[model samples]
Target: MQEASAINKEHDKPPQITRGFWLTALLILMFIANPLTAFAYFTSPDVIVSVHPKATIGIVYFFGVMSTINFAIAVGIWCWKKWAVYGMYLSVAIAFVINIYLGVGILGALFGLVGGLVIFLTTRNRWQWFN
Candidate 1:
C-alpha cells in the first residue's frame, strides 16, 4: 500500500520538464539576443537608410533598456527565482505593447513573447516555487 502511494505521488509530479528543457534553453538564449538586436537597431540607423533615423534610434534605445531588464529577469528565472517568472511576464507584456505601438520589426521580441509563455506555462503548476 505504501509503495502504491509513493508511485502515485511520483506520477503526480510535473512531467520532469524534459520536453520543455530545450524551450528553456532557447529562452535563455533569447535573453542574449535582446541586447544584441537593440544595439543593432540603434546603430543600424547611423549607417543605413531609414525614413526616420533619429526616431528609430531613440526607439531602439528605449527597447534596449527594457531588453536589459528582461534579460536580467530571464537569468533570474533560470536560477529558479520566483519573481523572475512573473516579473518577466509583466515586463514582456509591457514591452509587447510598446513594441507593437512603435511598429518595431525585430524578431527578438517574438522570441521573448514565446519564451515568457514557455517558462510561465512550464512552471505554473509548481506552486512550491511561487512560495
Candidate 2:
C-alpha cells in the first residue's frame, strides 16, 4: 500500500501557477515600463536634462540594465525556478538602495521585499523539483 501511494504521488501532475506567478507577471509589466521610459531619455537629450539635470547618459543606461534584470526575475518566477526567489529578494534590495539614492521613496521597494517573501514562503513546498 505504501509503495502504491508513493507511485501515485510521483505520477501526480505538477501544481499549476500559483499566486507568485501572478505577482511576478505584474512586476514584469512594471519593469518593462521602466525600459520603455528610458528610451525617451536616450532619444532626446532635452528630456534627460529636464528630468535629471545633474544626471548623465550613464544613468539612463543603468536604468535599462536594472529594468531588464527585473524582467528576468519575473520570467524566472513564472517558470517556477528556485533562483527566482533569490533574484526577487536581491532585486528588491538593489532597487531600494537605488531609490533612496535617487530620492524616489521606498514604498515600492518595501512592497517588493514583503511581497516577494510572502510569495516565496507560501510556495516553498513546490520547490522540491528545484536544485
Candidate 3:
C-alpha cells in the first residue's frame, strides 16, 4: 500500500523547469532586441538602407520578418518549447548568410552566430525540461 501511494504522489507532482543565468539573460536580450529592431525596420526602411548601402527596401522588409520570427522563438524558449532551439539555429544560419550577402565580411557574419552558440551552450543541459 505504501509503495502504491508513493508512486501516486510522484506521478501527481509537476516537473520543475529552471532557467539558468545565461539562458535568462539571453531570453531578456532577445525579448528586448527583436521587437525594437523589427519596429525600426518596419518604420524606417530608408534609414536602414542608408546605413547599409547594399541593402534595399526588400531586404529591410525581410529582416523585419526575421525579427518577428525571432521574437516568437524567444517566447517559445521562455515557454520551454524544444522547437524554439531549432528555430534559433535556423535563424542564425539565415542571418549569417544574409550578412555575407550584404557585404558584411566573413568575420562580421561569423560574429552574428555567437548568439546561437550561446543559446546552444546554455540550453543543451536543460533539454529534459524542454517539451
Candidate 4:
C-alpha cells in the first residue's frame, strides 16, 4: 500500500519541462541579470560616456529603475506566477519607449518581440503552478 501511494505521489508531480521551457528559462536568467548590468554601468559610467559623453546622470537613474523592474519581473517568472507574465510584457514596452526617447529603440523592440514569445511559451506550461 505504501509503495502504491508513493507511485501515486510521483505521478502527481508536474510534467517535465519542455525544451522551449529551457530556452524561456535562459531568457529569464538574462532578464534577472539586468540589475547586475545596471550596477556595472553605474560603477563605470565612463565606458558609456566614452561611447557617448552625452549620457547623463538621468540615464544612470533610468537604468536603475529598469534594473528594479526587471528584477521584480524575473522573480515573478521564477515563481511561475501569472502576474509575472503581464509584468514582463509591461517592462518590455517601457524599455522600448525609453529606448525610443533615447534614439536607440530598435534593440529594445527586438528584445520585446523575443521576450514576448518566450513568456508565452513558458507561461502556457507553468501557468498551472500559479494561483
Better of 2 and 4 by TM-score: 4
Query: Candidate 1: worst 10 consecutive residues by lDDT?
Result: 45-54
Candidate 4: tens digits of C-alpha lDDT, residues 1-131: 99999999999997874436564675567675887877876787667656545466778667777777777777777766678778777877776666666655586557656776777766676666665
Global lDDT scores for all candidate models: 0.67, 0.64, 0.94, 0.70
Sort by TM-score, best first.
Answer: 3, 4, 1, 2
**Every model: Cα RMSD to truth:** 4.9, 4.6, 3.0, 4.2
Which residue pairs of candidate 1 clash? none
* Clashes found in each candidate (C-alpha, N, C closer than 3 A): 0, 0, 0, 0
| Strongest candidate by lDDT | 3
Off by over 4 Å in 1: 1-23, 45-56, 104-112
Ten contiguous residues with the weakest lDDT in model 4: 17-26
lDDT of 1 by residue, 1-131 (tens): 99999999999987543425754776668677877866765666454336434345566667667767777876776666788778878877877776565555567457548766777677776636453
List the candidate 2 regions with Cα displacement exceeding 4 Å. Answer: 1-21, 24-49, 106-122, 129-131
lDDT of 3 by residue, 18-60 (tens): 8989999999999999999999999999998998899999999
TM-score for predicted model 3 compared with the true structure: 0.87
What lDDT is obtained when candidate 1 is compared to the true structure? 0.67
